[model samples]
Target: MTLSSSAERPSRCADAGKLEVSFEFFPPKSPESEVALWTSISRLLPLCPSFVSVTYGAGGTTRERTHQTVARLVRETDVPPAAHLTCVSATREEIDDVARAYWAEGVRHIVALRGDPPAGIGTHYEPHPGGYAYAADLVAGLKKVADFEISVAAYPEGHPENGSVDTDIEVLKRKVDAGATRAITQFFFDNDIYERYVERVRRAGINVPVVPGIAPVHSFKAIAGFAEKAGASVPSWLAQRFEGLENDAATRQLVAAAVAAEQVLDLVDRGVTDFHFYTMNRADLVYAACHMLGLRPKTDEAA
Candidate 1:
């Protein structure tokens, strides 16, 4: 039977077969957006994700807001929060202080990266005169501050700045050696690309969970624009899927859920279970996708 709307679908309870998920959110820029961010958090928290992360802005632009948001998550939420740290514009002393503060605040996990240059994407990234030069250096430094569980960025398709896949894997190996426990990938639509990258990573003897990053296509045009700048490929097939639907918000949501569900299920069938969603601070599409994956709000029995 055809469903009248997305809400018509019935909710299921958590399943016996386990599939762990995490979500990523960016710190809000305004009071109103802060309200929206928490609403999204409350909506998705019930899924009992492994952990949620708040993103740091380019060049530490949102350092204070990021700290505030992450501190609040530690203080108020049952789910663990991972703070993102970047080495783009800060000195080692400042970065170390941030790490120490997080540890003091009971924040133990961090997504460390060599953040984009302050000038913006595509511009050259210059390390601060006294800061860590790369993510591996930052990871090592964090380890010195505390035994924090660190996660670094990975790319299925090699990073834009890297000259080759081998170079990218070498960089990743350095981070893992430096104390990274996990690597969350840049989102990609093709499972083959991810699988290949994982194979390469494994062959290099860097053993860690490189979790797939999944972005539910909220706005195809917007995501396409981002993918373009971020050096991610937007498949021609994906474009066809969203063709001519830019004006249709309601139908677009439905299509977005379907596409994301299909992507995750296909990955599940291939023996992948853990996933990290770049939630973009919107919950409907992600919640719907999790529902289809047989995840549910924790009930007394499930909890």
Candidate 2:
């Protein structure tokens, strides 16, 4: 559950297919946060992720900001940008129009999702009338608009609303059938959970790369809160690692780094070559984790 900070960092992954990484960031809410987001983007850019995704706010709240950020990514950066498109509060035409705009702006990848309702109602989710009813439906609609590479979400631990993790896998199968090219799992701490989920995925005949999602703990308490709503479990041991470190930022950071590095390294040891990082719009811990994974800056011929 914990790794010493002094453990050796790998220089590279030698296994077949090697290692591939991608990052996720939410659109900024303010000018200061926007600056922080770009700062993070700069820090991770040199690691050369396959693509970086910008998240859409629930009910499409950050729709314009997501579009603007993605357009900038297309124009300003060398990396491919994947804009999140959700079937939240928009009509089919509206969503399609946004897709077309992204295509015109040189954005070729999309993260399609069936986002929570805009109104933030309780657990009962009813697809908005006249909108795509589910993520599978959304994926199909995105395909019709353009032949963009699509990445859909998978829940290794069942989604809070889903009664069974197996049911979530079935939905993932339909998404792949509808043209999703990849799947990024919900962030998970337990490798066993992810390994078993992948096993089930293969048994269901879904062969797409189901990348494990890694979330570096910026704040354990906050993350624990999110896990509760996300239907993901936070082990008691994790809390023990953070206990009494609330006021100690430096020590807490080291502990957080240790925990996340251990998680990813274990996955690497398990032969998982694909990874998706939920950056939470910050980069320090993520950068460190990638470094341990043998990802180096562009100037580093050592990578």
Candidate 3:
């Protein structure tokens, strides 16, 4: 699919009700990046995503920036902010303080995660000495701090450390048992992988909504690197879709939008309603995909 528009793809079902979407953003490290982050947020907010989440960096490195971004969204925009809290290197008390602070700021949703190790991807994860040990523990701790509508990470491709798909579902079950209300999966290119994971989660009796994570391919090379580290398999077909577009930014964006539209439309046909987009702090591809899904910019009155 070289430089095609989503209009070439099948139209969304007439009866497919408006798809619910949430976008993920990482905290910016500098003033210029912060401006870019908000610019992306401003563009996507008008689409009225179900919520927007700010990610915590490995070992809580971006904790403050993530908090500031979420707080600003709560105060300055109509988009619901779901702060990402991780149990990586902080004590239980420290983590609790952050959760309490978010509640104080009128932020109610949280995407709780067992963040990557301090040494970064592929390193062994060691829980903080006195902190919530895992995401399940973090969900329970956040509930103790406040009745947060907690969202936990679900690995459709078993977590690199966990080493098995069955075990991944078991871990997710523990999280749901520990008060997580939803599970947003790590991004996957194969819809069958996601479908099978959801089926297994249901068979295991973990009943919370498992929202599919949809990553619109902003940059094929960038996404491939992320997928490798994050344990998501990038199918050959997916790779072939972006072949030869490395130096072509404009064509890349168009192909990205079309590929993402096809993915979401396939999911919608499969009865999936909610989608969580890993926006990578850029708006165009994700915005275009959502527009293709029949989601429109929120009018002033709606806001």
TM-score of every model?
0.93, 0.93, 0.93
Q: Write the per-residue lDDT of candidate 1 for residues 1-303, one digit (tens) a residue.
A: 864753333222334257899999999989999999999999999999999999999989999999999999988988999999999889999999999999999999999999998654548887789999999999999999999999999988888776377888999999999999999999999989899999999999989998999999999988998787676789999999889888898888888999999888777766677899999999988998888888889975877
Q: Encode model 2's per-residue lDDT on 63-160: one tens digit a residue.
A: 99999999999999889999999998888989999999999999999999999866546556778889899999999999999999999999999878
Local distance difference test values of all predictions, in order: 0.90, 0.90, 0.89
Q: Number of clashing residue pairs in every model?
A: 0, 0, 0
Off by over 4 Å in 1: 1-17, 120-122, 300-302
> How big is the positional error of residue 202 in model 2, measured in Å on the Cα after superposition?
0.3
Residue pairs with backbone overlap in model 1: none
